[model samples]
Target: MKKQSYGMKWLSVEVVVILVGLLFLAPFYFVLTNSFKGFAELLVDTSGLPKSLSWDNYARAWEVLNFPRAFLNSLLITLFSALCMVVAASMAAYRLLRHPSRINRVLFSLFVAAMVVPFQAIMIPLVQVGNWLQFLNSIPGIIFCYTGLGVSFSIFLYHGFMKSIPLEVEEAAVMDGCNPYGIFWRIVFPLLKPMTITVIVLQSLWMWNDFLLPLLVLQKPELQTIQLATNTLFGQYLKQWDLALAALVMGIVPILTFFLVLQKHVIQGITAGAVKG
Candidate 1:
């Protein structure tokens, strides 16, 4: 009787887990299915499967959104932003960990505290500052903002992972006459892969899907990222559901592929803090 009860409890838990997962995936199903339907069909039957799948919407949206240009813009922004955060955070965290001076400690605390400061609180000031610095309305400008916003959390993650790496590794490098730059670039930085991949994946997803920041920083249609290009489908009066959904699906695919490829490293990153090098 006890064993049977335990088996039933486990089965119940599995059922609940599957249900919750499907609940989360419901939006994806809606978006994908609706993307295949005509705009009228979508409005008529949102819950039902499309009568037939058609690539017509994809074709139209691709040209309308200028997927190639928007994709290139998004790719550049995400790539550069992620790289800047990884490099800056990794180096800063290494300094904080290895040096442990009073000022460094205080700076580390400030970084942690900054993580809790909502972007909304600084949005207006950020715009003013960016304008003053001539850092608005360009891809590089947005990358700069993303780096500043992302650095705090990235440093925190690197700080944890850096703890797993032994100090003796750097000591040996020092004895071998490896300069500080060489020690960091060659020895320490390679050991940071798991967390590095994690930061890249997380930040890439955010910058790729993010609409608001790009909308603010990139006003020129020529500078539009995929999210902003997709937004063009919605006007003051009419929202082109078919084209919009298709563009959304197109926008989702590349980043989805990126995450799937690097997901193992993401898992490793999550567990890195518990295990030592």
Candidate 2:
């Protein structure tokens, strides 16, 4: 066998991919660069780099966004929401795979169906229900909401991953001394690390960056997450671009870092999940 020759067609495709990647990255460039500029400088030269790097905007944004509290709020909501989705989805998926009875099949179909139903369509009703249940204006309420929204897609992924796992493994565990919960926790769950990381990363990105649900539920300033807190920089009369951008940078860095660290697992998990389910 010989190496394939490089051609213009491949070069063209590579260039196109690079351009598209840059297009997507443009917003990040703008946000990061402008965050260091003054309001006047940003307005004067939207695309140009700042004449001098300034840390004042970030300092002000830190205090304005109440960085620590906001970060904590976002972190807690994301963590708990991911936890709820993972445990519920993985167990449900495992059960569905192991026993594909009529009711279970129908239940799985409903979970798939729920994935297609856009959240916007059910937003109002969900809000009303939350209000009725008195779960509004609280961190737990938002985490609860995230769980409900995220579980379907997560279950779908886990169901696929579960199918990839041989039943003989579970049987072996049963033959040894492992009970149901023991088999799941000690034997199966560890094997699900890739898919679990995928679910956590995906859900964390959603919950961490989420604005609409948090806005609707959390009205108190003290309850604000990173996105909600950063949004305070914009008003009808004035938009604090520099500070807002700085806060925005702060808001995105953690989630971006998280995705970078676990991105390989994400691809593997999604591929594994898609193999059967």
Candidate 3:
């Protein structure tokens, strides 16, 4: 009787899980199905499958949205920003953890405090500063901004994980005549693989998907990211639902591919971090 009850409970839980997943996926189903539809058909029956597969919407979206350029731009920005944040945050966290000076402690506290401060609160001042620095609409400019904004959270993650590492590891490296930079590059960094991957994946997703920052900073059509490019498909009088949905799908595919490939590492990183502290 107990075994039967356990099996029944497991089946019930499985059914609930499947239902929840379907609930989340239903919207994507609509988008995917309607992406091949004509605008008229979409307006008439938004939920139905296409009468016939239409490749024109995807092709038109690609050309009108300048998807190739946007994809390249997003790739460059996200990769550079993620790399900068990971390298800077990892080094900073390592030194701060090893040394633990009062200044370092105060600075780390300030970073954590900054994380709690909403980005909306400082958007105006940030824009003013960006304008003053003449970084308002440039790719390099936005990359720098992403690095700064991403550092705090990355540092927080690294700092927590670094606590689990032994001080003796650094001491051993130093005894072997390793300089600070050498120790960090060779020994410390290698041990930080899991956390680093976690930071890269999370930050890459955020930087790639972000719309507001790009919209605020980049006015030039040539400088637009994928998200910004998709927004252009919408008009005051006519919304190109088919084209917009296609572009949306195009923008999502790369990130979804990335997550699928690195999903195991991501899960392990989170699990390790949670167990450590």
* RMSD (Cα, Å) of model 1: 1.4
Q: For candidate 1, write residues 185-276 as lDDT tens digits.
A: 99999999999999999889988999888877899998999999999999999999999999999999899999999999999997995564
**What value does the lDDT take at residue 251 in candidate 3?**
91
lDDT of 3 at 98: 83
> Which candidate model has the greater TM-score, 1 or 3?
1
Model 3 Cα RMSD, Å?
1.3
lDDT of 3: 0.91
Among these predictions, the greatest TM-score belongs to: 1
User: What are the candidates' C-alpha RMSDs?
Assistant: 1.4, 1.7, 1.3
- Location of the lowest summed lDDT over 10 successive residues in candidate 2: 1-10
Report lDDT (CA) for all predictions: 0.93, 0.92, 0.91
Best by lDDT: 1
lDDT of 2 by residue, 27-105 (tens): 9999999999999999999999999998999999998788999999999999999999999999999898888799999
Q: What is the TM-score of each candidate against the true structure?
A: 0.97, 0.96, 0.96
Give one digit per residue, the lDDT tens place, for model 3 in 1-277: 9999999999999999999999999988998888898888989998877899889888999999989999999999999999999999999998887887899999999989989988889888889999999998899999999999999999998988787777789899999999999988998899889899999999999999998889889999999999999998788997888899988888988998998899888887776666453
User: What are the runs in model 3 whose C-alpha is more than 4 Å off?
Assistant: none
